[model samples]
Target: MKKINLKTTIIILSLIIISILFINNLRINKADNLSKAIVLKTNNSNVISSGVTNIGHQILTVKVLEGGHTDSKLKASNHFTGTAEIDNYYQEGDEILISIKEKQGKVTAVKAVDLYRQHWELLLFGLFVLILILYAGYTGLRALFSFVASVYIIWNILIPGLLAGQNPLLLSSFVLVLLTGIIIFSIAGFTRKGLAALAGTLSGLFITIVITIVFGNNMGLRGMTAPFSQTLLFSGHIDLNMKHIFYASIIIGASGAAMDIAMDIAASMEEIKLKKPDIEMKELIQSGFNVGRAVIGTMTTTLLLAYSGGYLTLLMLFVSKNTSLRRIINFKMVSAEILRTLTGSIGLVLVAPITALFAGWIYCSDFFIITWLKDLKSHLKFLRP
Candidate 1:
């Protein structure tokens, strides 16, 4: 006669969804030609440096260790592009990605494309999981599940929708809401705390989208400012609306940071409510506000640092050129980034109060008796009589 826990049921359902996504992705993205191989011998006699460029080729004797070409040995060629960044010089015993050309049930040719880096990546990921689990125990497992769920949802749902030329606004909106629910609920469970975080996140995302549209439309900024945007435009999707996608990017990027703020406030207020059931609505709201204030300063800076960190080289290039502040801000690339950083930070700032208010109304007020609110109300009434 044991009652099944609702939280456990939700987690199980989420796991099922993730599994489906994983399997479907494998089916759809199956690349039979790409396989892992290990270098057995290297003939680098052709490789040489010529006028600030690497002019040469690498011939590698390799054995296929994975995929359809397992246990096959072949001579693979690694051509040098003369650019340091594009070249991959392999030593003996280096694992690499090989593209196998098969014709009529026989391997025609094999070429080394890049390094087979999944081994090290998996090792690093395992280390992260071990540290997380050791530090936080069960909560860490929940966090890891949420992380994987987010990745699968993005890879399976969002990217495909965008590539299919679906309305960026609609797709982004749907994805934002979906991710918010999955991430917050997976961690906090189906509780008022999760509701508060979800509501606050969506509300802030709306603001971000509106601000992005208003500013993005009039900023005289083209969608080409986005990295690799030119390549995409000429990829036969000329009719695709890059401007709207740019706008979507702003909101989508801000949402994750905003959700963190919302969840922090909501969780803090929930703990407060549990510890002091007799607390007034105003007092609880104020406490939530206090918690928000404590975190907001550092969070905004963290957001700025995160966005800026990616373009450090570009910023240094600007600085090295003695680019005037006036001209620097006027640059389209810099301007677009300015808007993105500020808009995202604004969303973070707004979600704090929004989450606190929602947590207050949901936890302290009697008018909101959805689900567990009734049980909470048996002893604690948030409304002032």
Candidate 2:
């Protein structure tokens, strides 16, 4: 086995420690008044009152698993009906989530929130981590760390900032920059290739932002078209500009594909340079273009399919309703999807050439200089001849 580099070991260890601390702190600081309970018995025939629609109750026998009632050995249960059933229908032996209302350390009321499936969800995530590490080794570890960091930043910073009425465009742009730097540098390492990729990605992101800002409004897109956006406003974020959020989402969404193209081209160019140090600048640039061509072909379709895939049901609904093509195209949801896909694809298209240029300049600079001197020498010799 190859010996691990000391620097790499230290970096990985530090990142692991930081991740652990961050996750722990997040859990500790999470302001939620909830507890877990396991259902022992369920009775649906309990009628405490009569109503117009024959309102009944479900008395559930449960045992508290954690939180404020953890110390109580006696079993407990809560009666729920009506709107609570819309949240969940419980069964015996099922784990549930609950919140209790207490007065002077005595429980006044208990509400069953929903079913608990976090254990299986966490297990699935563990499997994903294991598969990633096994498949990609050190690179997978770096990718996982970046993923965690991205999630943490979004949850802790971006969400809170947006809720606090910060400018979504500016905040999202700053986040994109941070994510771009972290993802590229972490995956590619702090090398010339990484820098070239970062530069290319940022350039592509700039183009995406400009294009989105200029055309997104004309496309008649609003953040409210996004799922839960209206709910966000209704839930006390009235100060948020749904339009600006929509535009910012476009840029941020496109940035991932742009980064992919940039890294591909930059890495290709770096490899070509290392393999053929005597290659001319023009040849290196051409090689980068070739690499970009191959990447963008699939990547463009990837963005389109990804954006449209989620709206398959909506498309089917329109088709069933016999919606006209023109109307469908101009529909708010459809238009928003079109704008997102096109803008992201456009940014991805630009990433190739930008990355090619940056990589050629960074990786082939020495050879370019040498090629220039040789051309000058040949020109002088031709003049003499």
> Number of the top candidate by TM-score?
1
Candidate 2 per-residue C-alpha lDDT over 1-385 given as tens digits, one digit per residue, 9 for 90 to 100: 8887654575578678767877797778756567888887777665444443224556777788998687443334444445432445668888988777788988877777778988999899899999999999878877887888887788778888977879988899899999999898778766668878998999988888888888887776766788778878888778888899888888888888898899899988988888999888788999999999999999999999988898988999999999999999998889888889998999999989988988888775655544554565466442110
Give the root-mean-square deviation of each candidate in angstroms. 4.6, 8.2
RMSD of 2: 8.2
Instruction: Give the per-residue Cα lDDT of candidate 2 at 224.
Output: 78
Global CA lDDT computed for model 2:
0.80
Candidate 1 TM-score to native: 0.87
TM-score against native, each model:
0.87, 0.85
| Residues forming the 10-long window of minimal summed lDDT in candidate 1 | 376-385
What lDDT is reached at residue 323 by model 2?
Answer: 94
Residue 336 lDDT (model 1):
89
How many residue pairs of model 1 clash at the backbone?
Answer: 1
Candidate 1 error regions (>4 Å): 1-24, 44-56, 82-86, 368-385
Please write out the lDDT profile of model 1 over residues 192-273, one tens digit for every residue.
8888999898998898888888888889776778877887879887877888888888888888889889999999999999
Candidate 2 residue 238 Cα shift, in angstroms, is: 1.1
